[model samples]
Target: DQQVKQNSPSLSVQEGRISILNCDYTNSMFDYFLWYKKYPAEGPTFLISISSIKDKNEDGRFTVFLNKSAKHLSLHIVPSQPGDSAVYFCAAQFGGNFGNEKLTFGTGTRLTIIP
Candidate 1:
């Protein structure tokens, strides 16, 4: 069963505008992460994230918000730039242990920033 889902397969945003990417999960035990995949061969790089307990987490131009009641999370990139264009993946992790956790990933959403 797919615990994490990104309903929108792609999103387009104008440069210097805000880009919001959404994610949903069925598993309540999950702690979510937003990953950026710039190329097909390389592994996805960790972006911003929100813990299961926190409602929001911000880092520079990126922010992640989590809503436990709705089982949803979102990543917002303010003033989106061309370099921000990539395939983004939402991932949910279970288990608190560092090495023993299991991560379930969504299908991924392609974000395009128009200049």
Candidate 2:
């Protein structure tokens, strides 16, 4: 899990609206990126992931987009629901010769689903 800096500490969204969270990094050597959702006392639950070779990855209501040129990544939750409220984390690592031996996490984003 690769963690750097998360500019926005918290976000609020209507229960039925969309939630968009973004993360930025300075490193450009990573080959894979993953997103995790964390509840109060439970461990983070893996949400989605994308490889450097792909610009976007989607699963159900979650979608992750990567822009290598900008060294930026963003997560999109469509028709956000109250159950989606949680702390979201982003992790990245290299995959080939070095393997996924290293994982760094950036600061987390708090997504709030307003009612």
**TM-scores of the models, in the order given:** 0.91, 0.92
- Give the TM-score comparing model 2 with the true structure, all chains together: 0.92
lDDT tens digits, residues 88-115, model 1? Answer: 9988887577874666889999999999
Q: RMSD to native for every prediction?
A: 1.6, 2.0
Provide the overall lDDT of each model, using Cα atoms, as 2-decimal numbers. Answer: 0.85, 0.87
Cα lDDT tens digits, model 2, 16-78, are 888999988777878888888999999988889899999999898899999999899999999
Leading candidate by TM-score: 2
Error of 1 at 75 (Å): 0.2
Clashes of each: 0, 10
- For residue 71, model 1's alpha carbon misses the true position, in angstroms, by 0.3
